[model samples]
Target: MTASTKPYLLRALYEWCLDNNQTPHIVVWVNEHTRVPAQYVRDNEIVLNIGQTASHNLSIDDEWVHFSARFSGVAHDIWIPVGHVISIFGRESGEGMGFEVEPYQPENTDTQADKPQAAADKPAEAAKPKKGLKLVK
Candidate 1:
């Protein structure tokens, strides 16, 4: 499969927000791999302002977004996997883009046999068939 377009769109939106004199902010879904300040996280999600003055050494790459920012006078090294980023927008106007969360599938997992087939695992009744058949002539 081809690469995901999320990272490119994120970069573009960030640049657009800056160019429009708006502060860029990002919404991230917190996971075990996400490196962020726990105290600042609420409801398993965190909103971070990524304006030049708010963050240092910020880099938004294809795989992750890395940066350092101070929270309550404590500087933290934040690293968010690109897939966990829910959205990026202008903090001032709340105008930006939201992305669908893509589940991360590990390449080196040992539980292949233990895992059940995704389609087979779902109950067939979960999807109700059409109530009536179509007419054919």
Candidate 2:
């Protein structure tokens, strides 16, 4: 399979935001693989400020995005699978791109027994507007 372009686009937009003096933020779809503060998430998603001033040791690789930031005066490490990133936008201008949210599946799962029964038994549903990004005028 061809490699995904999402990570490259994300990195480029982040640099663009920084160069334009705008704060870059990312909208992430929260799932079992996502390691973010649960309290801040709403409707299974979270908007993260990823600007240089907000995050430390920030790294956006093909598979994951890692960073350390303070939340309510407590430092926490965040790990998000790149596939779960729904969108990237400037906090000020709200201009950027949005991508389809891919449900996470562990590669190591060898059998149906290793998968969650709820997920395995459930039928796929259409993506909901609330679960994905929307463009605002």
TM-score of each: 0.76, 0.78
Best by TM-score: 2
Candidate lDDT values, in order: 0.75, 0.79
Could you give candidate 1's per-residue lDDT for residues 20-112 as a string of tens digits? 999999999986646788888999899999999999988877767888899999988787778889999998899999999765443432333
When summed lDDT is taken over every stretch of 10 residues in candidate 1, the lowest stretch is 119-128
Q: Which stretches of candidate 1 lie over 4 Å from their true place?
A: 106-137
**Stretches of candidate 2 above 4 Å error?**
109-137
**Clashes (N, CA, C under 3 Å) per candidate:** 0, 0
Candidate 2, residues 1-137, lDDT tens digits: the string is 99989989999999999999999999999986677888999999999999999999888877778888999999877877788999999999999999999776665444434544432332222111123543232
The residue pairs that clash in candidate 1, if any, are none
